[model samples]
Target chain A: MNLLPTEEQQQIVDMVRGFLAASAPLERLRPDKFGQIGNPDAALWPKMAELGILGLGVPEEGGGLGLSAVEEALTYIEFGRALVSVGVLGATLGAHLAARTMPDIAAAIMAGTSAVGLATPRGAVAGDDGIFSGEFHLIEANEADFIVLLTSDAIALFRREEFTGQSERLSMDSHMRLMRAALESGKPLSWSSVKDGIDHARANLLIAAYATGVAEAALAGAVDYAKVREQFGKPIGSFQAIKHKCADMAIAAEVASCQVSFASVILSKNSDESRFHALASRIVAVDAALKNGATGIQVHGAIGFTAEVEAHLFVKRAHLIDFIGGDQRVQKGQFIGADAVI
Target chain B: MNLDYTAEDEIFRAEAREWLDANIPREVRPPDGPGMREFDLGWQRKQFEGGWAGVSWPVEYGGRGLSLTHQLIWYEEYAKAGGPNAELLFVGCNHAAPTIMARGTEKQKSYHLPKILSGEVAWCQGFSEPNNGSDLGGLKCRAEIVGDELVVNGSKIWTSSAHLADWQELLVRTDPAAPKHKGISWLICDMQTPGIELRPILIMTAPGHHHFNQVFYTDVRIPLSNVVGEVNDGWNVAMSTLGFERGTAGMLENIRYGAVVERLVDMARQRLGASALENDDIGQRLAQLRAEVTAVRAMTYRIASRAAIAPPGSEASLARAFFSQLQQRIRRIALDIIGPDSIELPEDDPWIRPYLRTYSNTIAAGTSEIQRNIIGERVLGLPR
Candidate 1:
C-alpha cells in the first residue's frame, strides 16, 4: 500500500500550486469579486487550458492530460485553495469523464474549443432520455460550449447554441456565474440504471476535493492573519481562543486533505472500496470546509465577513460545493446504502 | 497514489489470515461467553505463538518486526475474522509496550516486553486523577523519592481494567516546587504492590462490566528504577504515550464499530423489509449512513497509510476526532432505526446494551471535546 503521493504527483501539485499562486492570486481575484467559477478574467481560461488543467482528467487519446481522478482531484484542490472558479472544475471533470467513453466530445472539451457543465444534482431525475430539468445554478453556464445534463437515468450532452435563450448572470457569487436552462426530452449519450450511482460517486469526489482546497486556503488565511494581526500588544494568534480556532481549522483541513488524497488514490487503484472512500471524503471534506470556513471568518472577526475579505469567498465556495454535489443528508444516504450492500 | 496491497503484503495478509483461522479458537471470542480476561489472554497467547503479536515492534522485543502496513493488514484481517475485542490488553499491547520501547531502560524492556507479548501480564493506564481529567498536567498524585525507592501516595480515577490488570503505567508529581507540568514522573508500578488499592468503579452504562476503577496509592513503594524516563520529565513521556496511542490500531478499532453498524444495517433490513428501503426518505437515510461508513473506512485507511509511512503526528488526532464523532453518529442512526425498542431493556436485547456501551467510546479514548481541542491546536496550528 503506497499511501504517500508519488514524486510525480507531488511535482504536479507543486506545479499547480505555483501556477495558481502566480496566475490566480487572491489579490488579483479580489478585484473581480467573483469566486472561482463565476466570471474569470477573459485571459485566464485560455492560459489555464494551455497549462493542460482543462485536460487534467481527459484521456491521452482525447487530446488531454490523461491524468487519473486522483490527479484531477488534487488539481481542483489547488483551484479551491486559489478560490478559482467552479466552472473550471465542472468543465474539466465533465469533459474528462466524457472523454473516457466519448472520445470526440472529450477531445472538444480538452482543446478549450468546448466546455461542459453538470446541469443536474447527482441522482436527481428531471425527464426522459437523460434530459435533466431540475433546478441547477450553472457555474459558467454562459461560457460553456455544452452542458452535461445529468439525470437519474442517464447523462445527456446538450449543445449550448441549441438553446434559444441566453443564461442570466447572478450576483450571489461574482466569480461563479449562474444560469437556468431546460432540456426538452433530450437523447442520452448513454443510459444506465446505475448512472445515479456513478454521478453520486463522481459528485462526492469533486466536492470532497473542492472542500479540501477551501479548508486549506481558509487555514492559510487564518494563520497568516493570526501572525500579523496584533491585538493587545501581541499577535492575535497568541490568544488561546484564536489559537484553538486556528488549530481546529488546521485539524479539519488536515483530516480532509488526508481523506481526499486517500480517496483519490483509491479511485486510481480501482479499489472496490472506492465508493466508500469517495463518500467518506465528501462527508469529512464538507464538514471540514464548513467548520474551517466559519472558524476562518470568526478568527478574522469583522474583516472576514466583509465583502472585500477573501474569507467570505471561502465560506461561499464551501456552501456552494455542499449543495452542488448534494447536501450532507444526501451523501449520508449514499453512504448508508453502500454500507448495506457491503 | 495506490491503495492496492503489494504482492508481498497480499501474501503476508494471506499467511496471517491462515494463521488466525487455524489458531484462534471459536469458543474464546468475546460475546461468545463472558470471561473477557480469559478470552483476551487466550487470543494474545495464540497470536504470540503464531508470531503475530507485536507485528510492528522490533524482533528483539518478541515481535514480528514487520512493516506497519503489514501490521495494518493483520489488524484488518483480524477484525474481519470477528476476532475478540482486545480491550482487555489494549494498554499493554498499544501504549505500555510502545512507551517501554521508546523510554524504558534495558532491564525494563527485557522484563516487561516479553511478559507483555506472552500475555503473562496485563496493563492499565494510571494517569487521570479526580481533579485532573482533561488537565492532566495538574495531577495531584505525588511520588516522593527517598534513597533508592519512591514513595507514591496519590490516587488515579477512571483507570480502565485496573481490577484485572497486573501492571499500571502511571504518572505522578515528583517535585512540588516545580511547575505543574515540569514536576511529574512516569513510573511503571506493579498493580500488586503494597498500598495499591483498586476499587472497581461500576459504570452506570455497563452494569457488572468493570471497565474502570479508582486506584488509590497510599505510600506505595517501588524501586526508583521503575521510572521510565528522567525525574520531572514524565510529562513528555506521558505525551508520547498518548500520541502513539492514537494510531492505526485505534483507527482499526473504530472501523470495527462500523462493522457493528453494518450489522445493524443488516438487522434493519431483515426487520424493516424491502418496502422500508423503497421509501425515498429511508433509502436516503440508509444511503447517507452507507456513505459515512465508507468515509470512515477510507479515512481509517488514509490514516493507516500515513502511519505506515511516517511517525503519526497531528493526522492521528484528526482521525481520532473524526472517528469518534462518526461512531456517535452511527450509534444515533442505529437507535433511530431501532425506534422505541432501543429504550427497552430486555436482558437479551443486543441493541439496548450496545446502545449504552457506545457512550463510553467517545469518553474513554479522550473526550470528544478534548479531541477537538487537540485537533484545533496541535493539528491545525491554532494559537492555543
Candidate 2:
C-alpha cells in the first residue's frame, strides 16, 4: 500500500527539476510584447532526447528507454511546469503506438529526427479502404513530419504530404499555432485496431499529466510573486487574502499531482480501474490547473491580466490541455458510466 | 506506487472483516445518547477482546503493535463493515493513550494504556476554551502548583463526551508570567474531581446527540504526577497529541466517508430510479465528487506512506483540512440528491443530520481557515 515514490523516482524529479530550472526558467515562459511566447534559447528537442525523455515510454527493443507510464508522467509534469510545447509529448505518444508496426518511425521519433502532430478526434473519419478523410484539428501540425489521426474505432497514421489543405490559427497559449487540415484523401498505411477504451484512457492520462504541470507552474508563479511583492508595509503574502489564495492553489496542485500520479500508476499496471482513474485524473487536473491559473492571475493583481506575465501563460496552456482531452463535463460523464472505484 | 496489500495484510484484512461481520449489529446504532454510547463501548470492548484494538500502538502498551499498513487495513475493513462510531471511546483510545505512551511516565503508561484499550474508561480533550477556541495559546484556564498537587480553575467548551468521560487530557495555563504558548501544561484530569461542572450543549444537527459539554473547573486539584510532560512544554505535547489525532483519525474518517458516499449513491439511485444519473448536471457532479473522494483516498495513502519516510509536521493538517472539507462537500451533494427530504418534518432522514453536522467538520479540531493559515505559513513557507 506504499504510494510514496521510491528514492529513484524522487531523483528523477529532482534531475528534471534541476535541468528545467536552469535551461527553461519561468522568465522564458513570459509572453512578449507582440503576444508571442518568449521560450528559452535552447534546442529542446535533441536536448530532451539526450535526457531520454523522448524515448521514455517506448520499449528498449524499439530503441527507446522502456520506462513505465509513471516515469513518463513525472517528466510530463516537468514539461507542464516549464511550459514546453506539446509537440514532444504528441511525438512520444505517436511513437509508442507505432512501435510494434512501424519500428522505423518509432526509432526516428526517439532519435528526434521526426515530429508527430496529434489531431483532434472530432472531424476525422476512418474508411475501410485504408483512407481517412476529414478536416483535422492538429497540434504542432506545421512542424510535424507525421500526423496521428484518432477516431472512436481506430487509430491511423498519415504523413504531412498526404494532406491537401492546411490553415494555421493561433491558440490561447503563446507557443501554440493550432492548425486545421482539410484532408483530400489520407492513406492509413497501418491502422492499429485500438479500442476506444484504451485511447480515451491514454488521452485523459496524458492530458491530466500536462494539466498538473500547468497547475504546479501557476502555483509556483503565485507563491514566488507573493513572497517578494509588497503592498502597504509588508509582503502581500502576509495578508490572509493572498495567503489563503496561495494555500488553495497549493492544495489544488497537490491534489492534482496525486490524482495524476495515481492514474499513471494504474495505467502502468494495466489495472481494471485504469479507465476510471484516467478520466477522474483528467477532470481533477483540468479543474486544478484552470483554478490555479485564475488564482495565480488574481494573486499577481493587474500584471497577471496582461499577456506579459507568466500567470496568463499557465492559464492559457491549461485551457489548451483541457480542451484537447474532452472537457470536464464529457470526462465526468464517462467516468460515471465507467463506475470508477478505488 | 503499488497499492496492493501484502499477503499478510490481506489476511489481516479478511480476519478483521470476519470479526466485524460477526459482531456489528444488523441495525444502525442510535445516532447519539446513552444507547449510542453503549453501542460504541460495546463495540470497543468487542474489538479489544478480539485483539483488534490499538493496532499501531507499541507492543509494550497492550496493543497489536502492528504496522501502519495493518492499521489502515483495519480502518478499511471496519468502515466496510459499518462499525459503530468511535465517539464514545475516541479520546482515550486514539488521542490520550497515544500521547501518554509517547511522553508519560512509565506509571502513567501502565495506568492509562490498558484501561483505555479495554474500554474501562472514556476520556475527553480539554484544549479549546470558550474565549480561546482558535487562539488556543491565549487560553486563560489556569492551574497553580500547590505543593505536590495542582489547583485548577478554568472553563472549557466544546469538550465532547466530557459528561460521560472518566478522565480528560487537559491543558491549562501554569505560568501566567511566561509567553502565551510557553505557560501551558498538559495533565490528566480525573473527571470525578470535586468543583467540576458539566453542562451539555444541545445541538441542532441531530436529536439526542448531546455529546458536547461546557465543563467548568472551579478548584479541581490534581496530583503533580498527572502532568504528561514537563510543566511548560505542554504546547509541544498538545501539538503532538493533535498530530496523532489527525493522522489516525483523519485516515479513518476518509475510509468512513468512502462508505458513506457509497450509501449516498445507493440512496440516490433508489430515490431517483433509473433516471437518477440521466441528468447531466447531477451525473457530472456525482462523478466529480467520486473522483475527489478517490483522490483524497490516494492523498491519505500518500501521506501515510510519507509519514514513515519523513518526520511528522504540519503535513497531516493538509490532509485533515482537505478531508474535512471533502466530507462537507460529499454530504452537501448527498442532501442535494435527497432533495426536499432534507427539510421535511421529523428531519429523521439520515442524510439531513449528517449534512447539517458537516459544519463541525470544518470548525472542530482546527477551523478550515486556521488550517489554510498553517498550510500557507508552515507548509508553503508563505508569510505569517
Candidate 3:
C-alpha cells in the first residue's frame, strides 16, 4: 500500500497548485489592517469548469474529469491552501450529487451556467418527509442559484431564493460568508441520503484533504515567518521555543496529510472501512488545521492577529470548512468503536 | 496513491502469517536479567532457525532479504500473532548488524553479522557516556593508540545490558585535540576485556530487574582492526545508521501499537461495559488516541512508500517524536482504564509496566527537544 502519489496524481496536484497559486495567492489574504480582508478570490466558475475542477469527481459521461476521490481530494487541498471560497466545494458536491441521479442539474453546475452554495442546517430542521422551514447557515450563498442543504442524514438542493433570509453581515470568514437564511416552505429540487447521495465517505475525505492543506499552509507560513522575522538579535526560529512549536506544527500537518491521503486511497478502493478512515482523517486533519492555525498566528506575533499576514485566513477557512463538514465530535460518535482497528 | 496490495504481497503476507502462527514462542519473555537475555536470544535464534531472522537483511548476511514492504508484513503478522518481544537481540540485529553491513570492514562483517543473525551473541550501544546523552558528540570517553590496540578509558552510562553483552558498538574520543564532533571513533569493544567493569543500574519501571548498566574502563584494550571506520571519523560512521532505527521502529511497531490501542479499547469496554465509549472523558480520550495511532501508521506508511523515490530524512524524527508521545498517551489511557486495580492489589498488570516504562520514551533515542531541533532545522529549514 504505497502512499506516494502516482505520477498522474502528482501532475494533477501540480496543475491544481499552479492554478490556485496564480488565481488566489496568499498575498490576497494579506490585507492592510485588522478587520479588513482582501478581495476574496471571486469564484471564477467558468475558469474552474474549463479546468474540470468544479465537477472533478463526476464521471466523464456526466461531463466531469471521471477522476476518483483521490484526485478530487488532492485538488481540494490546493483550494484549501489558497483559502478559496467554499463555493468551489459546494459546487463540486452539488455537481457530484447531480451526476449520480440528475443529469440536467449536473450539466448546468459543471458547465458553470449555474452555481451551488452549501447550506448547513443551523436549527434549520427539516421533517423526515423533506419539508423545510427554519434558520440555515449559508456558505457562498449570495452568489449561487442553487443551495445544497445539509441535514444530518442527507443533502437537499434548492434554488437560493427558495430559502429566503437576511445575511449575517459580519461573518468570521468574509469570503465564505457565514449567513443565516430562513427557509419558508421548501421542497428539494433534488436530494439523496448522505450515504448514497454525495457518498459521505468521499465527502469526508475531500474535506479532510482540504483541512490538511490549511494545516500545511499554516506550518509553511509559521516557518517562513520564523526564518526572517528576527527577535533578540537572531531569527526567532533559532529560539528553541519558536523552533519547537514550528516543529510540532510540521509534525501535525504531516500526520494530517498522511491520514488524508490514506483515507482517499481507501475510499478509492470502495473499502468497507472507508467511513472509518474518513472519520479518522477528518478528526486528525481538523485537529491539525486548528492547532497549526492558532500556532501559525502566534508565530507571526502581533501582525498575525491583524490581517497584515495571511495566518488568520487559514484558521478561518479551516473553521468554515469544518462547520459544513462534520466536526470531530460528531464524527467521533459515528465511527469510533470501542474495539478500534486500523 | 494506490493502496492496493499486489498478489505477491498478499502471498508474502500469508506466508508471514502462517509461519508466525506456528513459530511465535508460547512462553512470555522474562522481565530482565540473565533469564530475560536468554529468552530474547532464544526467540531470535528460533526465528533465525525458522528462516525468519533479519527479515530485511541481504541474503549474503544470512537474512531473508525481504523487501521493505514484506518486512512490514512480517512485523504486522508477528505482532498480530503475539510474538515474543525482541529485547536483547534488538541492538544486535536492528542496530549493530546494519551498521556493520554498511560501514564495517570485511572482517567485521564476517565476524559479527553471522553471529548476530544467528542470535549467538548480544550487542549493546555505548555512544552515551555519563556526560553525553543527547549531546553524543561531547563524549569524554577516551581511547589512546597503543602498539596494536587502543587503550580505552572513562565510563559509559545507560549501556543497556553491558553486563550481558558480548560486544559493544562503542564510541571513544580518539583524537582529543580535534573538535568535539571530529575526534570520535566507533569501535566494536569486547565486553569481556580486562579492566572493564559493569555496574547494573536498577531502572524505575521494573523493580529488582535491570536492563541498564554503568560501565567503567580503567584501561580497557581494543584491537585497532575492531574500529568500524577511521579514527576521528566515527561520528559520521555512527550517524549513518541512525535514521534506520527510526524508520524500522516506526514501520515495524506501528501495527503493534495499533493493536495496543485496540487492547485499550477492549479494556475500557470490560471496565465500562458495552457503553464504554458513551463515557465522555474516557471514551473521547480513547477515540482520540485511536486517531493518533492511526495517523502514526499512515505517516509510517508514507515514509515507506516514499522510500523508493527519496532517501529517508528528518521526517523520521517527526514520526519518532509522535510515536513516543503516543506511547505515553496510550499508557496513560491504559492506567486510567485500570484505575485502582494498579495500586490496590498488586497483580502483574501489563498496562502499568509499560506505563512506567513509557515515561522514558520521550527521553530515550533523543529527547523530544532534540527531535524538534532536528525537525525545525533539518526538515523545516529553520535557522540553526
Candidate 4:
C-alpha cells in the first residue's frame, strides 16, 4: 500500500520530465517575436505520439504504453512542472475517450496525428433524439483536429467542423489558449459510456495530479529564490517570516501530492470512494497550487511579480487546470450528500 | 503506486472490525482525570488481554507485532468502533516504551515493557519545563549523579496525566556546565518518590477536565540504572522516539477528524436550510474541511507506507505541522457552524470541547513555529 513511486515509476517520471525539459522548456512561455505568449506546437504532437505520451494509460493490447492511471497521473505531474500545454491533457484524455468505440480515432489521437482539445461543456444536454447541445469552452484547442467535450456523466468527441462557431479570446492564463464553441449536434452523438461515476473522477484526478505538480514546482522555486535572494544583507530565507512560508508551502504541496496519489490509486482500483476522493483531491491540489503560486511570488519580492520569472506561470496554469472540467467551487457541491457516513 | 492489500490484510481488517464491534465500551471517554485514566487503561488492558494491544510493537515485547498496515487497520477499526482515546497511555506506549525498546537496558525492558503493554502502569513525560516548553533542549530541570543514584530538583509543567502516572520519563540537566543541549539526561522517575508533588492545572477546556499538572521535584532520588541510555546522552535518547511519534501521531484521531467534518457538514446543512449549498461562508468552509481531512488521511497512509512504519526523517515535521493546523481549522470551522449554540458547552454536544481543546494542536508537541524552524533549517537547508 506504499504511495511512493516505484523505481520503474520513477524512471517513467524522469523520462517524461527529461523529454519536457529538452523539447519544451519554461522559456517557451516567454513572449515570442510577435509578443505572443504561445504558438501552437504542431510538431510536438507527432513526437509525443512516438514517445507514447498521449495514450500512456491505455492498455498495450489497445496500442498504448501499457500503463495504468497511476503512470498516466505521474506523467501529468511532469507536464505540470514543465507548464506544458493543457492540450496535452486534451490529447491524453481524448485518446482515452476514443479507445473503446472509435478505435481508429483513438489510434489517431494516440499517434499524435490528430490533435484533440479538452473542453468544458456548459449548459450541456443530451436529448432522447440523440442530440448533444452545449457551449463548449475549448482549452488550447486552436490547433486541435478534434475536440473532446464532457457532459455531466459521460464524454463525447467532436470534429472541429461539428461546432457551429469557434472564436479565440484572450484568457487569464496565456500559457493555455482558451476558445469557445457553440455546439449544435448534427448527427446522433455516440457517448462512449464510462462507468456511472468514473468520468468525473478520472478527469478531476488527472487535473489534480497536474495541479499538485504546479504546487510542488512553486515550492521549489520559492525555496530556491529564498536561498539566493538577499534582504538586509542576508538570504531572505534566514528570516523566520520567509522560512515559515516556505515550510507552509512545503506542507500544502505534501498534502496535495499525497491526495493525488490517493485519488489516482482509488480510481485505478475502481473503488466506490473514488468519486469522493476525486472531489476532495481536486480541492486540496487546487488550493495548494493557488496558495503556493501566490506565496512563491511573494517569496521572490520583486522579481516574482515580473512576467519573466517562472513563478507566475504556476499561478496561471493552476487556475487553467483547476477549471478544465469545472472550477473547484462547483465541484464542492458534489460532496453535499457524499459519504458523510462512510 | 500500489494500494493493493494482501488477502490476509483484508481478513485482518475484518477480524479487527468484528472484535471492535463486540468489545467497544458503551460509555464515552470522560473529559479528564481519574475516570478518563481508568477508562483508557481498562480499554487498553482489554485489547492487550485479547491479544490486540501494541499492534506496532515487536512480538517479543508482548505486542501483536502485526505489520504497519495491520496497525493502520486496527486503529481505523478502533476509531470506527468509537474506541476511547488512549490519553493515559501515550507517554508510556508511544514515547517511553519505544525509547526503552531502542535504548533501554535489558533490565529496563524486562520490567517496563510488560507493565506498559499490560496497562499496569501509566507513564507521563517530564520534559517540558515551565519556560522551556518548545525550546526543549534548553530545559532547566537539574539532576546530579550521587553514589549509584541521581538526585533531581526542578519543576516540569504541562505534564499530561502526571497526577495519575505511576512513573515518568524525566529529562533533567545533568551536566549544567556543558552546553545546554548536551547536558540533559533522560531518567525514569517513580511518581511515588519522596519530595515529588503534583499541582493540577485547570486548562481552558470544558468543566471537570484537569488533564495537566505541574510536577515539582525537590531532591528526588532515582537509581542510575533507570537511565535509558548513557546519562549525559539522554538528549539523543529522548529525541529518538519523536520520529515515529511525530510521523504517525494522531493517525487514529484523523479518522475522528473526518467524522467530525462529516458531522459538521450535516450540521451546516441543517443550519443553512435550503440555501446551504449556496451559502458561501459555512457551506464552502465545511466542504473544504472534508477535503483537507481526507488529504491528512492520505498523508498518514503515505507515512505508514514507509518500510515497517520506520522512523521518518525530518520530513515528519511537515506532516506534523499540516495535521495539527488542519485539526485547528476543523475545530474552528465547527465553532462557526455552531454559531451561538457554541457560547455555552452543552452536555450532549461534541463540538465545543474539541473546539476548545484543539487550541493546543499547534501549541503542543511542538509549536507550529518550531516545526517551521525544523523544516527551514533541517529540510530546506535554510540558515537559522
Candidate 5:
C-alpha cells in the first residue's frame, strides 16, 4: 500500500502553502489590525474565491472547481496554518453542501458575496414558527450572512437576518469569532438527512485536518526556535532535552498529518470504516496538536507565553478546535460504537 | 495514495497465510529458553523449506527476491497467524545477511547468504559495549592486525542470542589512533573462535532467558579476509545494518500489536461488560488506541514506500520512536482496562511477561532519547 500523496496532491499543497504564506499571513489574521477579527478579511475572501478555494468543495456545475474531500482537507490545512477564521470553513462547507439543494446560497458563497457559519445542536432549538431560538453557540456567526444548524440527524440552513438577538464573544482562538444568538424567525434554506451520525463524522475528519495543520505549524515553530535560541553558549537544539522534544513534536506532527490524509481518503471512498477512521483521526489530531502546542511553548521559554508569539496562538487554536465537530470524548464514544472490531 | 494491496501482493499474502496456517504450531510456545531457541530455529527451517525465507533477498542468494512490499505482506500474515518469534535467527537473516549482501566479498556472500537463508547458522550482533550504550561510535572493542590475521580483544554486551549464535557480525576498532568512528571495522566472527566466550545475562522477567548475553574476545584471531567491508570503514557498513535493523521489523510488530489489541478488546468486553461502552472515557481510549495502531501502520507503509528511492538512515528513527511509544501505549491501555487483576495474574500469564518487557522496546534498538537525537540532527538538520 502506498500511503504517501501523489505528485499532484503535493503540488496542490505547495500551491496552497505558497498562497497562504504570501496572502493570509498570521500577522494579517491578528484582530488588533482588523476591526473585530470575527469578520472575514474582506480583501482575502475575493482572493480565496479567485484562487478557487471557496469553490473547491462545490461541484463544477455550481461554478466550483469540483475537487475531492482530500483537496478540501489540504486547503483547510493551509487555512489552519494561516489561522484563517472558522468563517472560511463554515462558508465553504455551507456553499459546497448547498450546491444542489440551495443554489442561491451556493452562488453567494462562490461569488464571495456572503459568509456562512455553523452551530452545533447543543444550545440551538427550533420553535413552532421554524425560527431558531435558544442560545446558539455559533462559530464566526457574527460575520456569517447565513448559519447552518447541524443537529444529530439533519443539517439545515438559515439566513443571518432571521436572528433577533445576537452577542459576540471571544473564543479561545483569537482568530475565531464566537457568537451567542437567539433567532426570532428563521427559514430553512435546505435540509439534508444524515445517516448514522455521518455528518459529524465527516466534520470530525476536516477538523482533524485543521488540527494537524495547527500541530505541524507548532512543531515547525518550536524546531526553528530550538535551532536559533541559545542557552549556555549553544543552540538549545544542541542539548538533548530540547532536541528530543523537537523530535517528538516532529513525530507527532507527521503522524497527525498522515492520519488526517488517510481519514480524508477513507471518507471520500465512503468506506465501511470511514466514520471510525475519521473519529480516530480527530482523536489523534487533537492530542497531537495540544501536546505539540504545549511543547512548542515550553521549547520557546518565556517568549512563548507572551501573546505576541505565534506559539500561544496555536495552543489556543488547538483548544478551540478540539471542541469542534464533537469533542475528543464524544468522537471516541461514537468511533468505538461505529466500528466494533476493537 | 492507494492503501489496497496489488493483485500480486494479495496472492502472495494468501500463499503466506496458507503456509503459516498449515505449519505454525497451534499451542502457545514458551517465551524463551532452550525450547524457545529450538522453536525459533524450527520455524525458520520450516519457512526456508516452504521457500519463504529471505523473501526480500535476491533469488540467486536462495531467496524469493520479492519486493519490499511483498516482505511486508508476509510479515503481516505471519503475525496474524501467530508465527513463532524468529529471535534466534534475526541477526543472521535480517541484519547480518543484508549487510553482507551489500558489502561482503563474493566468497563471504556466497557462503554466509545460503547458511543464513537456510537457517543453518544463527548470527548475533557485536556492536554495543558496556560503556557505549547509545554512544555506539565510542565503542572500544579492538582488533589489531598480526600478519595475515587480526587479533581481537575487548567485550561486547547486550548481544542478544550471542550464546546460541554460530557466527557474529562484529564491529571492532582496527585503528584506535584514528578518529573513533573512522577506526571501526565490520568482521564476520565465528562464535567458536579460540578464546571467544559468552556469559548469558539472566533477565529478571524471564528465567533462563539466554537470548541476551555478553561476549568476550580475548586474543581471538580471524583471517583478514573475514572483514565484511574494508578495514577501518566498517562504520558505514554497520550503519547500513542498523538502518535495516530499525526499519523492516515494524511491519510485523504493528500486525502483532493489532492481534494483541483484538484480544485486549475481547478481554475488555468480558471484564467491563456494558460499562466498556457506557464509560465514554474508556470506550474513547480504546477507540483512540485502535486508531493510533492504524496510524502507525500507515506511517510504516509510507516509510517503506521510500525504500526503493532512498536508503533509510535517520528516517527509520521516526518509525522506531513512534512504534516504541505506541507499544508502550498499547500495553498501558491494556493494563488500564485490566486494572488490579493484572497485578495478580498467574506466574506464566501470557500478558504479564510482554507488559513487563514493553519497557525494553523503547530502550532497545535505540533509546527513544537517542532516536530523537538522530531525528533532530539528521532528519531535521539541527546542529549536533
Candidate 6:
C-alpha cells in the first residue's frame, strides 16, 4: 500500500541527486561550441560509472549492485532533473541487460572499462544476429567502447570501432552527441532475437520507465521556477493560469511515476500482470512527457523555447523518446493485441 | 505498487460477482439501446435491493464497509457483468452520502443516510451558479437567516439530476456583507419546498437525456437544522465534498471506460474485415486510440495505487483531467472508425448517442479547461 519510496531508496535518491548536482549540472551540458557533436562532457561518463549507477539494476553476482528497476528509476528521475544527457538512461538500461546475459561484458561496463549507447529501430541499423550497420545517432558512440543496437527483432552489442561511422553535430540539445556509423556485416559480440511476446514487453517497460523519469525531472524544475519567478507584483505561481498548468504537469508526473513503479514491481515479482502494466506505463509515460514538456515550455514563456534555458533540453529529449521503440502509433497496435489476449 | 488483490479481497470479489449474477435480472438490464435516465434509475434501485449499493460506504451506513480494493473489484465486476451505468444516483452515492457521513449531525445521518442507501431518495449537486462555475468562491446564491428557518433566494445552474432528485445539497450565501468565500452555508434543501422550481435544461449533447437542470429558489424556506455543518462555515463542508469527489472512484470509472474502449476496438476489428481494419487510415487511428486508452488505464491505475496507500488529493486531479481528455479522444476515434455510418444511424442506434453523449463528459464534471488550470496551479505550482 505504500507509494512513497522506502527509506533506503530515499537515501539512494539523495545520493544520486547530489552526484548530478555537482558533476553534471545543466549549465555544463549546454551546446556552446558551434557545429560541435553532443555536449563534450565525455569525462562525466566515467564519474557515473564510479558512482556505480551504470550497474544499478545489474545483479550483484554479475559484478554490480543489484537494485530493482524501481530504485534504478529513481536514479534516472534525478538524472532528468540534472539535465545531464540521455546517455545516463541508455547506459544504465543497456548495462543492466548486458549484465544479465553477458556477465563478462557487464563487469567491464560496471567497472567503467566499457561504455554503451542505445540504438533503436528508428535510429540505426537493426537486424538478426545483432548484425546492425548504419548511422547511429546520439551514439555517445564516440565515448562508448560498445553500442547496444536495438531493432524491432533483436538486441545486440557491437564494438564501437568495428564499423566506420561519421558524426553529424546538431544544434539542438548540446548535451547529446549524434553519430552515423556505416558497417558491412559488423561483428556482433552477442545477439538474441527479442521473443515475439516476451522481449518487446520488457523493452517497452524499460523505455516507459526511462521516459517517466525524464518527465518527472522536467516537471520538478519547472515548478521550482514558477514558485520563485515573479511577474507584476507576485510570484508567477500565484497566478491561477500558471498554477493550473503546474498542477496538470504535477498530476501527469505523478500518474506516470505511479505507473512506472507499478510496472517495476510487477516485473520484479514475475507476475502475469507485467504485460498489462508495461503497456499501460509506456502509454501513460509518453503522454505525460509530451504534454508536460509542452506545458513546461509554455510556463517558461519565451525563455523556455530558447536554447539558453535547460527547459528546451527536456523538450528535445521528449521528442526523441516519443518516437523511440516505435511511436505511439506502433505502440497502440501492441496494446490492442495485448487487450485481445486478456 | 503491486495491484494484485489479497486473498480476502479476491474472495469478496467472487462473492460480489455471484450475488450480482443471481440478483440482477436479465430483463432489468439496460437494453442494448441508447442511454436512458429512467432505465438507469430502475437498475440503480435493483442494485440497492440486492445489497450491492454503496460498496465504499461504512457498514453502519448500509454499505459493505469493504476496503477500497474491494470496492474497486466490485466496480470491475459490475462493469463486466454489463450492469447499467449508475448515472442516476451518481451524485447521491459518490458525493452527498460521503459528505453527510463526514459532517452530518446524528439526526441528519439517521434520516438521510438510510434513504440514500436504500435508493428511496435521489440527490443532486448545487454548487455551480450562472456566474460562478470555475470561480466557485464568487457564488452569489443567497440564504438569509429568518427566525427558525433559512430563506434561500438564488439560482444554481448545471445541477445534474435536479429534476428527478428528492434533495439538493445546496450552497448559499448566509452573510451577504462577508467576504465572497466566507459566510457561505451548506444546506439540504427539500426539492418539494415552497418557492422551489426546477427547470430541466437540455444540455446540447443528447436530445432527450436531461442529465442537467437549472434550479431556482425564490425565498424557499428550509429548516435551520438542515445545515450539514456549522452555520457560516459551508465552505469547509463543500471543500470536503470536493475532496472525495476527486479520488479513486473517479479513477475506477476511467479504468472501466478504458476497458470499454478496448472492447470497442476489439469489436471494430472482428466485425470489420482485416483489410478494412488494416489498410485504411482507421488502423492508424485505432492504434492511436489504443495508445490513448492504454495511457488512461495506466494513469488510472497509478492513481488507484496511490489512493490504495493514502487519500488521493491534488494528484487525482491529473488523472481526472487525463481520463477526460482520453475519453474525448476515444469518442472521436470511435466516430471516425464508425465513419458516416455513425451519424447515419437512427436515433435509437445503440452506439451513436452514447458516442455523442461523451461530448458532455468534459463539460459536465468540470470543464477540461478548468482541469488544466488546476493542474498548472496546484500541481505545477504555477501562477494562477
Q: Note the B-chain TM-score for every model.
A: 0.94, 0.95, 0.97, 0.97, 0.95, 0.91
- Worst window of 10 by summed lDDT in candidate 4 chain A: A186-195
Encode model 3's per-residue lDDT on A1-342: one tens digit a residue.
788888999998998888878877777655453235423644468888898888887899988989988898888788778777777777887887778678988998998878788887665375466677777787776667888876545667787888886576566776556668878768877776645623766767777888998999999999999999988899999999999999999989888888888888888777777777877888888889999999999999999898667888888877777767445665565555523555
Computed on C-alpha atoms, the DockQ of candidate 3 is 0.69
Q: Indicate whether candidate 1 or candidate 4 has the larger DockQ.
A: 4
**lDDT value for candidate 6?**
0.70
lDDT minimum window of 10 residues, candidate 5 chain A:
A123-132
Residue-by-residue lDDT tens digits, candidate 3, B1-384: 888779999988888888888887777777877888798888888889988887778998898877777787788788788886677887888788888898999999988999999989999989888878999889999999999899999999998888888999999999989989999999998888899988888888745467789999998999999999787999998888788777765576677888898888777778887464654578777778888888888887888787756657677888888889988998888768887766642555577777888888898778999999999999999999
TM-score per candidate for chain A alone = 0.87, 0.89, 0.92, 0.92, 0.88, 0.85
Model 1 chain A lDDT-worst window of ten: A190-199
Per-model TM-score on C-alpha atoms: 0.90, 0.94, 0.95, 0.96, 0.93, 0.89
Estimate the overall C-alpha local distance difference test score of candidate 5.
Answer: 0.78
Task: Give candidate 3's whole-model lDDT.
Answer: 0.81
lDDT by residue for model 2 over B1-384, one digit each (tens)? Answer: 767777888889889999888987666777777677677777778788889888888888779878788888888888777776767787887789878877899999998899899777788899999999999999999999999999999899999888778899999999999989999999999999998999989776655468689999998999999999899889988887676666656777787777776676666667765354744566678777888887887787777787667635786776788788888888888767767666673634667777788889889888989989998999889988
Q: Which wins on TM-score, candidate 2 or candidate 3?
A: 3
RMSD of each: 3.3, 2.7, 2.3, 2.1, 2.9, 3.5
- Name the TM-score of candidate 5: 0.93
Docking class of 6: acceptable
Per-candidate DockQ vs. reference: 0.48, 0.62, 0.69, 0.68, 0.57, 0.43
After superposition, the stretches of candidate 6 with alpha carbons farther than 4 Å from their true spots are A1-4, A31-37, A45-47, A122-138, A161-171, A183-187, A196-200, A227-248, A271-276, A327-342, B28-50, B270-281, B308-310
Q: Show where candidate 2 strays beyond 4 Å.
A: A32-42, A121-136, A149-157, A160-165, A182-199, B206-208, B266-279, B345-348
Best by lDDT: 4
For each candidate, the alpha-carbon lDDT, in order, equals: 0.73, 0.79, 0.81, 0.82, 0.78, 0.70
What value does the interface RMSD of model 2 take? 1.8
